[model samples]
Target: MLEGHALGVHGEGVSIAPVDFSLARGGRLTLLGETGSGKSLIAQAIMGTLPSGLAASGELTIEGQAYAAAEGATRRALWGRRLALLPQEPWHALDPTMASGAQVAESHRYLRGLGRRRAREAARRDLVGLGLGLADAEGSLPGELSGGMAQRVAFAAASAGGAPLVIADEPTKGLDAPRRDAVVRLLAATPQRGGALLTITHDIEVARRLGGEVILLRRGRVVERGPAERLLSAPRSDYAKRLLEAEPSRWPAPPPPPATCGEPVVEARGLAKWRGGRALFRDLALSLRPGEIVGVVGPSGCGKSTLGDLLLGLTGTDAGEVKRAAGHRLAFQKLYQDPPAAFSPHWSLARLLDDLVRRHRLDRTAIAPLMTRLGLDRELLARRPGEISGGELQRFAILRVLLMEPRFLFADEPTSRLDPITQRDTLALLVELARERHCAVMLVSHDPALIERLCDRRLVLGQGEAVLAPESLDAQAV
Candidate 1:
């Protein structure tokens, strides 16, 4: 259903090597690579949504319709009805002010030509099919949902128009193993219905599950492409081998139990929180000791993030008290799930860094070395938050927090957008620095393997029965 010859992305001083492929109906093609390696760029090129300053080159044929790949406009009208692009870290893709159901309904009403009543009903059914049938879910705004919840909502909205050919960019990010599998099933259904699918992902497991063609890329170049079964199981290229090795499941166990922890940096007792008329958590008790790495896990909207916010004092709790060790006011920091949300889109990263330094009286000398450690380019600092790739911006957010020498940090899916090798390396650097500075860390990730690999202990949330609730909270502190 989709065919491309020498498909590539081109821009000032950068370009993705030309690639050729044909995705027949009922076939799946996954683009796997490190962050900024141009996985998403290919999807964008096909969707005719390449960001400013970048252009697509080559020839593309979709559903027997041929067009110049560079003519982005030629495919514009097909965006919703024939082609759809599911964005990465989709919270930003959703409408913050609109109710979830309404957003989905909009696509059906306009793109699919459904009436208001029919569109609304269709949207409701879509949400329900995705397990978002809870009475309150359809009414909630993007801000009211968890990272995973927001991602599903975006998916519902994007696919509402019944687009046959789909481009999913990191569709399973910020979701637990079960949710990830569920989404993969959903993506698979498109091809089963005789539509073609092109997926962009960093997850080796996701590619294995998709079970079709796989293209491995690095630094805007294709290292290899072949059947998923062969490429992933017995990759020939060195980079491919390294990429597969970087999966959290293959990581070596962390060094013996975290160095004898120091005094508690923060403590929460009998903590409880309720959102949108549902109890998210109750009787949750945990403490963070200096230099201790704690991991958080659970299903989407299970209050993992709410718990972090409670500990960070970002929100008020109905029943709990949190005490923090006396230290610099800025010592407590959080690396947000949506890194772009944490920065000013209007200002350059350098300006934001400068502002933080001036506001906190932090030392500027540490910036260069920290940037190097985080694998960031000095030139990137001149771009605004909206200008860089999601993974790049996420790393920059980490750099900002590290500059303050935080005593306690809540990293909320900080590496969700990053590729395997980068994810492993970034986490390693974060662990090393946190240990050296004796900073407490509360890390949250959907991958159980990743948690088990780096955390001193794990806290699982959402194994309760209260209607999208955590009242009967199952607190397993492993």
Candidate 2:
């Protein structure tokens, strides 16, 4: 159903060298790559949504119809009906002002040619099936939903059109194992229905479950192309080998915790949060000490991120008192779940980092070495946040926080977008820096193995409850 000859992307901030490929009807092709490896670029090139500064070239054949890939307008007409691209950042595709159900309903109404009543019914069904409560899903906007919640809503809207050709970019990044499985099933359904499915993801597990063709990319070049099972189990490329090794399960368990943690940096008691008339969590009590690592795990739309917000004072708890130790006001920092939303599109990364350095009177000399350690290309500093891949921008966010030498850091799935190798390394650095700085860390992640490996304690929040697991992280702790 899809074929490309020398199809590639080129632009000011990013570039993907030309390559050739084809996808027959009922076929699935997954793209695996590091952040900024041009994975999303290929999907955008096919969708004809390349940014203004860039353009696509070569030839593309869709549904057996040939056209110049450069002629984006031709592909634009197919959007929402014949083809759909679920973006990496759900915010980019979601209408912030619109209610979640309304957005999905609109797709069904227009693209699927359903009446308002039927469309609304379908939207609610889709949302509920994805584990969202109907009232909560319909009443809330994109900004109010968690990253995983928003992603599921976005998927519903994109797929509501019943488009045969679907291109999903990092669809399962912030989702729990169960939800990830649900989404994988949905993507697999596209091909099972005799339509092609193209996905871009850093998740090796997603690739394994989908059981299809895999294309591993590096710096815009294809390094391996074959069956998913073969490539994942017996990858020929060294980079691919490292990717498999970087899985949280393969990582060695972290060293044992200290005999006694340092004094408390922040403490909260009787914390409670509610959204859209639904209780998220209540009577939650926790404390963070210098050099301590606490992991937060819960299902999508659970109170994991909300708890962070309450602790950071970004949002007030419905019922609670929080105490922050005497320290620099800026010593408490937060790394956002969606890096794009946390940054401004108007400014280059360099300007943003510089402003932070100036505002805090930070050590300017530390920036260069930190960038190198984080695998950030110096050239990326010249580009705006919107110009970089999600993983690269996320690392930049981490870099910004590390520079501040924060007393307490709330990291909301900070490495979700990064490739496995990068995720492993970046997190290791985060832990190392936090310990060196005597900083406390509160990390929220969907991967339990990751939490088990890195944290001294676990907070599992769901259905109006918060359970603090044991410090040793034993099975009973969960």
Candidate 3:
């Protein structure tokens, strides 16, 4: 249903080497690579959405329609009908001004030519099928939904028309195990609809779940391709081998546990948060002790990120109190999930870091050593956040937070956007720094393996409260 022959992307002075591949109707293909390997570029090339000044070469055919020379409406029509993309960043993919339901209904209304009422009904059903309630899905705006909900809404938009070819770019980027499984099932079942599935991702588990074939890319070149199981198990190239080995599942055992947990550095008591008359969580209580790493896990929209915000005093609790031990306010820091949003678009990395250092009266000499330890180049400080890869930006984000020398840290899915290798490295660095400083760390993530490896205790949030689960007791906290 989709084919690319010697397809390449080039701009003013750079180019992505040409690559060749094809997917038959109902077939599945996964493009696997680390950050900066041109995975997204290849997807953009096929979708005919390459940025201005960057041109695509060779040929791209979808549903037997050649797009090399297609123009205007011809290309646009292919998007919602013959081809649809589930973008990497779900929040950005949506139209903030439009109601979520209306945006999703557009696929049915335009591509399938359904009546307004019918399209609305179909969209509601699609949303419900993806685990969202009819009321929440229909009434919420993009801004009103959680990251995971926005992702599901995007999926509904892409698949509503039953497009012949669906291209998903990291569809399960920020979801828990349950939601991830749901997405995997959704894509796996796409073939039964007489369509093809093409996904560009850095997740080995995602690729393995949507099994069929895998194409490995490295530095813009195709290094390997074969059946998913065979390719992953017996990769032919050295890069592919390293990629497989870098999976978090293969990481060595975590470092030895902290010798002794220190006094509570930050504490929350009887916390309650409500949004739009709905309770996110209530009467939540937790404490962060120095030298301890706490993991927060739950299904999406269960208040994990919100809890992080509350702990950091970034958001006010509707009821109850958050208490930081004396002199610990400035010693508290947070690592946001969306690094781009956390930064000002107008500020260069240098300016942002400098401002932080200046405001905190921190020594400038501490900057270079932290950057080196995080595997970040000192040169990156000169570029804006937009100019760097997500992994790099995440590293810098961590660096910026760490520079304050916080005694307690709140990290919300810090490695969600990163590839496995980068994820491992970033986690290792964060843990190391936290240990050296004897800082208390609260890590919010959906990856169970990560929680098990890094956390001394886990907090499971659901149904309006967080239940603390200590590793030693294997018992739930009241």
Each candidate structure's TM-score, on Cα atoms with residue i matched to residue i, is 0.95, 0.97, 0.89
- Local error of candidate 3 at 108, Å? 2.7
Please list the C-alpha lDDT of all candidates, in the order they appear.
Answer: 0.86, 0.90, 0.81
Winner on lDDT between 2 and 3 is 2
lDDT of 3 at 285: 82
Clashing residue pairs in candidate 1, if any? Answer: none
Model 2, 1-478: lDDT tens digits are 9988999888885668888888899999999988889998888889887777889989999998898988888888899888899889999999999999999999999999999999999999999888888876776899988899999999999999988899999999999999999999989999999999999999999999987899999998899899999999999999999999999999997898764466799999998888877788888888889998999988888778888888988899899899998888788999999998989899999999999889889999999999999999999898889888899999999998889889999999999999999999999999888888889999999998898889889888777887897646453322
- Order by lDDT, highest first: 2, 1, 3
Which is the better candidate, 1 or 3, if ranked by TM-score? 1
Alpha-carbon RMSD, each predicted model: 3.2, 1.6, 3.0
Off-target runs (Cα >4 Å) in candidate 2 are 259-261, 475-478
Q: Where is model 3 more than 4 Å wrong at Cα?
A: 12-15, 69-74, 260-262, 274-283, 328-330, 346-372, 376-388, 473-478
lDDT of 2 at 378: 97
Model 1 spans > 4 angstroms off: 464-478
In the range 1-478, model 1's lDDT, one tens digit per residue, is 8999999988855589899999998999999999888888888889887877788999999999998998988899999899999898666688888998899999999999999999999999988877775565799888888888888999989988878899999998888888889889999999999998899999889999999999899998889999999999999999999999999999996777555556789998888877767777787778788888888887787788888888888989899788888987898999999887788889989999999999989999999999999999898887888767888999999999999999999999999999999999999999999989999999999887888888887777774321221212334532
What global local distance difference test value does model 2 have? 0.90
